[model samples]
Target: MEFFEKLKALSYRARLTIVLHTVFTLAETIGGVFFNLYLWRLTSSLALIAQYQFFFWLAMMLGFILIGYAFKNKGMSQLFRIGFWLNFIFFCLIVWLGERSINWTVYLGLLSGLAAGFYWSAHEVMVLSGTSDKTREMFYGVLMSGESVARIAGPALSAGLIWLGAKWRGEALFGYYLLFAFVALLFLVTELAINRVKDVSFERFSLRGVFGLYQRKAWRWNLWRSFVDGLMISRWFVWGVLSYLILTSEVWLGTMMSLVGVLAIISNILIGQWFKPNLRARLNSWGAALLVIAGIAYPLLLNPLGLVFDQILGEIIGIPLFTFAWLAWFYLAVETDYDGKKRQFEYYAGHEIWQGIGRILSIGLFWLLASNLEQVNLARWWFGGLSLLFIVQWWLLKKVRTALVKAGYKEE
Candidate 1:
């Protein structure tokens, strides 16, 4: 009850931003997870999926590079609209392609990447502008809670729809079409709603200027954090979990994801109330340690029982800690310099580029490794490597905290 009141007390722009984000999150949750499943069904080749993801990240990097130019010339609102429309077009392509989606997976990946790059870059800036450091943590908590609810509903709804379609017409693809169409409609609504939100002024930005950050010792930790974050996103969540799902049932996948979503909701609430800014550094360290442990436990994917335990452990223990801590750290890093307001878009674009490089390396390695190894050995080695990467992420997180402290940024 108190939480609801506090959420309602947010400024109009903040509330609008949260609402818009929730809608977008719901639409994404509906179809985003299944898109990979759709591809795997079309072509049961891990290498092909890796290729698609590689191209996706590559294109995303390119999109980030162009984001600065877009922001300077067009403004954040236009970039947001372009992203929304591109995503709609991508889903439409998925429907049109149908089972033949395998034929154009690479191209689809590129399209998806471009859409994500533009949408996320603009979205990050909006979040920064809409909330202050005082309200940032609470706002993110509400946002994440909303997203978790959407995630819970989205997967179940998608799975039920797919099941019904398969039962009625003897083809689950029909359900996918329905899901994509629904999401496309949501995108249209989002496009219209975006107009109601205020826009940020155009600021001078350059891709070349991003190079200057590399020269600053104070900003070096952010670069490392970006790369590590990218690695985790690709190796653990994208390829690692997807690989497990490929071996399991869709019903099980949907159920497990919903369970995780429920746990996320609880974590969001707790973090919102208890996570203090002063405790950020210590908490983040603990969170990164849990992630490393989760990565080490990835070998449990060998058997069904072990797989279930592994998922439960990750969702219940590892994800909530790491997710909240990382987000808090990110907010700190972005807002610490205060100059982020005028150059926020450029900073985000640069962050995306670094993250993209990390993902490219990860998926590229996955493609190469999977090509050479058998299924059993591949899972072991792939997840084992991912565990090592998590350690690197932890190290980077610590360094980031140290760097921020040295730069005279207040812990609270």
Candidate 2:
């Protein structure tokens, strides 16, 4: 009853944004579930997968940099619309190219990445603007729940549709192209919904001012943390790929993803309700440590089922606990720099540069290692190595937290 009351109190802008997010997110998930699989079917090259992903993050980082300048004159709504249309165009190209898309992986990846980078960057700002402190919690809760449900439902339905369609249409590629068209066409709904949102103005900071944000000590430290965060959240490191390879079945892949999605939803619910400031250090530490454990343990199994177990620990337990706790730390540490207002968007832009670099490096490193190392050892070495950075982040948080407290900063 209380949650419903809060939900009812949301502004129209918030409502429309929620609708846009739900539809866009659903289409993205449906299209994404099989996109790589389609590529894999065409070429079966991990190196190509890594190359496609490398360019995606490369363009995404560039998109962030360019959008920062664009925001000087353009509204977030306009940028979002551009991203929305670019994504629509991306899917349209995939449908049109069909088998030929395999040759254009790098270009397609760049287009999609730019679309994602701009859309997410602008959309996040819109979310912050659309709701006040009183209603923000409920707004995010509803948005997250919708996203979670889409993750659960989209792949399940798409997998079934493709399997059935293979028999009816007599070609697997036809099912994929059909799904791409559906996703591309679905954007019309989001386009209408987002246009309904009135543009709200934020204080514009000069590009010089935005770039100068890096001079501050607190934010400088946060960039390092966010870089590791990006490495952890790499551009093309979807776990289901390994699962699909091992299981050799789309249905199995969807089932594993849905089960993991259910567990993630449950974990997020529990974490959101139970998280506390005093417990931040402990939870984040546990989460980081668990990720390392999962990474190291996963490759040992060498079975398709290992993917499910790895996701259970990594996504459900490790990711949520660490992510929530680290986010709490960011609010306390990073967002508190020098009045923290008049430059919120600038802070976001500066952070994106390093984070995007980190993502690009992640795939770049994988490609290099794939050249020399055993493919089987990739997860162990990659996850183990990256998890070390989490520990570094954990220490940085402690140092920054104490220093901020001494400097008279407090979590809002």
Q: Which candidate should be chosen as best, given TM-score against the real structure?
A: 1
lDDT of 2 at 314: 78
Encode model 2's per-residue lDDT on 188-233: one tens digit a residue: 5566556634775446545686668667666667777778667865
TM-score per candidate, chains pooled:
0.91, 0.88
Per-residue lDDT of candidate 1, residues 7-91 (tens digit): 7767776776677677777777765667776666667667777787888889888997777775574557787788889988988
Q: For each candidate in the order shown, give its overall lDDT on alpha carbons.
A: 0.72, 0.69
RMSD (Å) of each candidate, 1 decimal: 2.4, 3.0
Q: Output the worst ten-in-a-row residue range by lDDT, candidate 1.
A: 235-244
Q: What TM-score would you give candidate 2 relative to the actual structure?
A: 0.88
